[model samples]
Target chain A: MVGIVGYGAYIPRYRIKVDQIAGVWGADVQSYRKGLLVEEKSVPAPDQDTITMAVEASKRAIKRAGIDPREIGAVYVGSESHPYAVKPSGTVLAEAIGACPEVHTADLEFACKAGTEGMYLAMSLVKAGEIKYGLAVGADTSQGAPGDPLEYTTAAGAAAFIFGHDKILAEVVETYSYTTDTPDFWRREYQYYPRHGGRFTGDPAYFKHIIGAGRGIMAKAAIKPEDIKYVIFHQPNGKFPLRVGELLGFKKEQIEPGLLVTYLGNTYSGSSPLGLTATFDIAKPGDLILIVSFGSGAGSDAFLFRMTERIEEVKDLAPKTRETLEGPKVYVDYGTYAKFRKKIRKANE
Target chain B: MPTPARYWREIPQRYRLEAGRCRRCGFIAFPPRLICPGCRSREFEIIKLAEEGRVISYTIIRVPPHQFVDQAPYAVGIVELDDGVKLMGQIVDCPFEELRTGLRVRIEFRKIMEEGEAGIIYYGYKFVPA
Candidate 1:
């Protein structure tokens, strides 16, 4: 019954409202508000990046796990915005949490699904008895081009999960993955911002993969939507997850707790993992949770988890997802956001 | 070019807030000293310094060094940790005017500096409002 032993999430303090971003490009704010269902998105401080956020979240996870950091045998970080192109984010995270010298670490990228990929690998390794404990993190300081539609939602945040055989908070019952070669969104090497296929990112991409994995996992686990207490889908936006949930026979109530994109925006690799963290915040013992993550290269990784009594003990060990989302947020105007995002060009040094 | 070895050697302190506490006099040293200055103790225990602290003094760097020109006007402060170890770091996530002696803060991992646009990024601890 290898599963999550501890989990933690981190959201930056700074935020930029949807209207503020819309006003810059003279886009209709009401359309985005009504359509995407995103209000404001988190922004990372200049000093914060993928690695920094991952380290913070992993620290909280270590605290919650209450296990010796030296016991962790593997560290994997999933992010599209890793600070160094070559250096692994996992190594820094491992060192920060005092898990160095004995840990195997790697950085993963599959767009938004990268985090779940790490989760899948870590859980599998733990289940196989290949490691005593494994740490997986999904985090990103996602990039969007200036005045591009992606700018409104591309945001920063991170979530980490520690997998082990003992003290399981949520027991992994089943796992499923659906993937294909779909070029819906991509950023070329040396490109600062990603380019997307716009409407092409829908139906054939996010929806198809998510529904395939969601239904596939439900079938493999031999459970109906009514049997699950909560469902979290990779939330590129508030609308997509809701619509997809309904399509998968889940009610609005079951999906709403994890529907954080309305406030947190799209944190890329952090999206679904953060949602699962939020669901874990309120889920009870014996509750069933289904988390399905979608990445732009076009794939979904779905996992079915059954909560254990230990969930109560560690849910409050770190900052709750909702508390951080609704905590004291420093709102930045578009100009400040541009500066923070480093949109303005400067002369050569 | 800045030497990576210099940065590499400080990983224990920079990444984990590791310090050396003298076994004889209980003097705590950041960067983990080889010999205790207080009691001349050669033996020590490596420990992590307290993460939470309070500002004892601070100065706003309005004109920063070459590497930190963009981050000028930031507040740098000396902090006294709960364990009595004093250290200097940048104070962030608060208004400059709000900073004062005795304000509570906690250490957070952050990017301290990077070498130009394409070099090794140095990460360390910074103070944030607790």
Candidate 2:
């Protein structure tokens, strides 16, 4: 069976604190940690966008797999924000990945689940002998309204996975999915901030779908909650995943390693895969991992994976905290955050 | 007024912070190139850089570009920008004795050189102490 040959993740160097957003809005006083379920979030520089992050992650994934990029037969990008509305992000990615000209190329968008959805598709292709190898990537730079809690945690990042039949880092054990049509979160055409059914998002939609998906996968695989070595859930905040995990019987240790959403906040599409990559960093050869994704407006995909011996050969390829993300913040005033988010227009000189 | 040949291709960058970058890694070439040394992607992005950078390395340009002859004894250094990009430009407004790695400098738009005898007055961004 085809499986994850290699994987890599990226988080930009800059992070913003949720309290910083609260201080600017003058809203009800709340702990930043409680509000966004995030303490800090990553920010990409002007030049670094979804494409650049994908390329960086792709390079690392390619290296970890120890395969020539030209050997790959397909490239798929899963992103909400493509640089040019008309341009193909997959083509730029293919060029960067050095994929052969004969490869198939495509871009997929299924909110947050698109990354793993692409992963499964790649597995099917490579498994069926349609292609020698395939690449799947999920990356995004979501916009949050300035002063809103989402602004504090709606950060940027990328993660890429390569799938093939041999030398797999982790073999796919079982897969299950629970999809639904719920308006938990959504953005319309030309809309900057996503319109979300706030209460609906946190409780009924996210929790329900995530819980359902995890349970479905667990039940289908006949693997009890204790059997999972690591569980990575789509992180909108620090609390949701923990809540879902506990309700489903996964203890703190099994889920703690991937809770970057608590610190780096919600990276939209990048969150779940990056969380998985983090889990892979500490995983042992026989470890079984479960990853669940929650995308607003809304669906969930759960993946069951077992680590392979090759994962131990190179341990350094994993998601990490950037030094800038650790730097002392500037304690940005509301005006500056507004400028940074392009919320307010400043008059020209 | 500008001469035809100089006006068409290489004239402008001779005066400022314009350079070609590797289409692949986005690494900018200093004396810009037709082919990027980084990844060698034939295609490239053209950029007008911010002049101010930290002194990555330095030397007094005791020998100067022909156009900069009158500006002898000038200090030259490689400055890495706050943006994590590195580029080369003359270090102005600070004495040669003061220039060192990690020194803060600001970019000022100015003329770097002009071709002799009937060249357009060149304009470029140069680094000055912030």
Please provide, for model 1 over A1-349, each residue's C-alpha lDDT reduced to its tens digit, 9 standing for 90 to 100.
Answer: 7999989999999999999999989999999999999999999999999999999999889888899999999999999999888888888899999998998899999999999999999999999999999999999999899988899999999999999999899999999999999999999999999999999999999999999999999999999999999999998888999999999999999999998998899999999999999999999999999999999988999999999999999888889999999998899999999988899888997
Candidate closest to the true structure, highest DockQ? 1
Instruction: Please give the lDDT score at residue A39 for candidate 1.
Output: 99
Best candidate, lDDT: 1
Give the Å shift of residue A315 in candidate 2: 2.0
Native interface contact recovery, all models: 0.78, 0.00
lDDT of 2 by residue, A1-349 (tens): 7688888776654556666667667765466666556766776643356776777688678878888787789898887776656657787677645574778988888777778777877887998899988998888887777655567678788889999988898999988888878877777887877777767787778888889999899889998989888999998878788888898899999998877886677777888988888888788999999999988778888899999999897556543333223433334454544554557764543
Q: Give the TM-score of candidate 2.
A: 0.73
DockQ of each: 0.88, 0.05
lDDT agreement with native, every candidate: 0.94, 0.74
lDDT tens per residue, model 2, B2-120: 46475435533543346677778888775578887767778877775554567788788778766666567787778888766776777764657778888888654334554553454
